[model samples]
Target: EGEWKVMLFTCSYSVGGVHGHLVDYMQPEAVSTLLGMTYGEYDKRYKSYFGDVIRKTFFDDVGFVHMEQTWTPAITEIFREKYGRNPALYYPALFYDIGPETGAARIAFYDIRSELMAEGYVRQVSEWSEARRMRSMGHPPENYSPNSVVAHGDILKYYRHVDIPLLDAILCFRRGLNGFKQVCSAADLGDKPVVGAELCGAYPEEMDSAMLYRTTLEAMARGVNFVVSHGMWYDTDPQTVRIPPLIAPENPLLGPALKGYSTSTGRSCMLLQGGRRIADIAVLWPINAIQAESYMFRDAESGLPIANWHPNDVVNYALSGMLTNDLHRDFTYIHPENLTDGKVSVEGDRLRLNNAENLQEYSVLVIPGGGYISAGALARIGEFYDNGGKVIALASLPS
Candidate 1:
């Protein structure tokens, strides 16, 4: 029988978590890109590995991936050349904006509702109205888009610093489907085999398999075909199995469903085995529980609230472990007897991997910066660069 392939739901740096963690996804030439070396310098290092494959096939090893906020025509083209497949992109549902930067989105909406009216969309009208009001005041409400038509109702400005300008970006996408109709118009993404693909804090912690299963069933009936699930944030730290801060320990987030999916991950299909799946329906479950138990999510990362997103806060307060049920007919994720034995960790703090010596043996690492990584870590990352290691760092590297 042929092996069943699994898709890994990952955002380039979300997989890394920090600069040293960037070794989790690095290639030799990536090191040159870091130190500002010319492609020739990169090629010099590249030849050390497998000769011309560096110029020809290095990126092929990384396979299919989507940048959370950096999806562009050029990026799309790059993926096509390497994977021979279209790449999935992440578009936030918060607001829409597109044009030659004439600020068309701002003028398009008489308010948020008018755009919906223009698009003839009627689902969740009140929510749209609230977002409109917030946008007008230079403050937009929070929103999550699992699929085009289906959005969760966990709106709240957890960012503290409002995302009013995000409206422009969303407008660019939404109105494009209708000749720049209204900036606030959503993309013509009506039930396009949507996947909740990934979520941070859309579900409340009180939710369990019953709620997750029921929601999945309804969304699928509405047009969604699968559920990729948002987790299994394992790393080689071997000491910290961090989960997101929005899950509850006793909730079904730690149940059998996820474990089944994890086993699906270990299968030998080139895609699944490669660890690159854009989940169609991801339940952001248990990491929430781990956070609540430790109160890690409540603290801030360099002043920002740790559980920065409120719905995420609710999730962390609810989950207990990392076991998933079989949304598919296959394997599951089992709870780690020792948290260190697993890959996901959630002490709630961002940007701390103990010390510098911990960065060996990793091929690619991610450095997530809510704003910026610490100076000490930054220098350590420079060493990683000097050593010809690769990093998938954010905030630390220029995009």
Candidate 2:
């Protein structure tokens, strides 16, 4: 039996409860008896080690769960071992400018942190699920905003191992619609068959059938095929409820519409799933620029540390809104890592995004305004431009 202890931290927000942090999920000592083995050895034995739990659960799907701000001393040690340098040395650069190497250090810090999470935790669970004939699904917090860097490292890289990339869509409809394109883009780039939204959890009590249907359809139009309504409650007492908009048959207003909503959503998912997304434009995700531009500084009044808002933070959301709503043109976001890793390439007058199962060709490569870019991605863009592909640079050119 696994005897893992929860690490709790006080909630910073108004929710006012202690948040429990799980073990890094890669920690052999906490998870199983497979201690003192190298990661390679652990990987080989992971499936069989978890066989009893997998068999006992009798579940067709497994979730890796939400990984948000999951960092520890063990992670730092692994980071040092993997990168051959202590991450502590980069702290000055990570938070504030240290000199010429500051940008490079920040880039490396964020990149390695993202890589460690993806390889150490996310990929392990994903591969395990695949081996067990179960599907893996989940999302990191702040998945839809520039805050994704602080929360999940790199949103695109974070989802690389996930079988179904999910986005948490809470709050009101207007606010919830902001980051759907980003998650959908991850699914498209990965060639994953399904994209999920954990929707309508914290909406007001006034949330009606119209609001629910509108939100669902909007999410669907943005490339979501799976919807996990967040969620139904067992207890109907209003006093026991925490998150609002309780989705249950007991709810007097939205209850009667549940059955029909479920049916239509099912049909929608069946039609949208397993199809290649067709788009002529590919927006570069500019994660490199975002990482390079972001830094922490002390707040003026409270004297607390805070992250500065970079101008490029909302560029993705803005571009998505323009292309998707105004221009009526469809597009997908291609990550800078994809370009650097050779998953994306120049094919004559087109840029081809190729993965294990899906291939998408874009005629126009739209690079949004960010002053910094990875050299490898820049080289790929140059090659594409030289090969006669349309290159659109928004705001300013990346240095």
What Cα-based lDDT does every candidate model obtain?
0.25, 0.70
TM-score per candidate: 0.22, 0.80
Question: Candidate 2 residues 1-399, lDDT tens each?
Answer: 799644333222213223353444444344333222433464476666554554211111112223223344555566577678866766666556778777777777667667766665566656656766566778876565544565566777778888888886777785636567888898888889898888888888878988889888888888899988875777878777788788888787889999999999999999999967788899998777777755543112223222224454337667888887788788889988787777888889898888766678899999878877888888898998999999988887866
Model 1 CA deviation exceeding 4 Å by range: 1-196, 199-206, 235-253, 258-399
lDDT of 1 by residue, 180-250 (tens): 11111111011111122122223443345444445433323222222334333445232443433222332
Worst 10 residues of 2 by lDDT: 56-65
For each of the candidates, the C-alpha root-mean-square deviation to the true structure, in angstroms, is: 26.9, 8.6
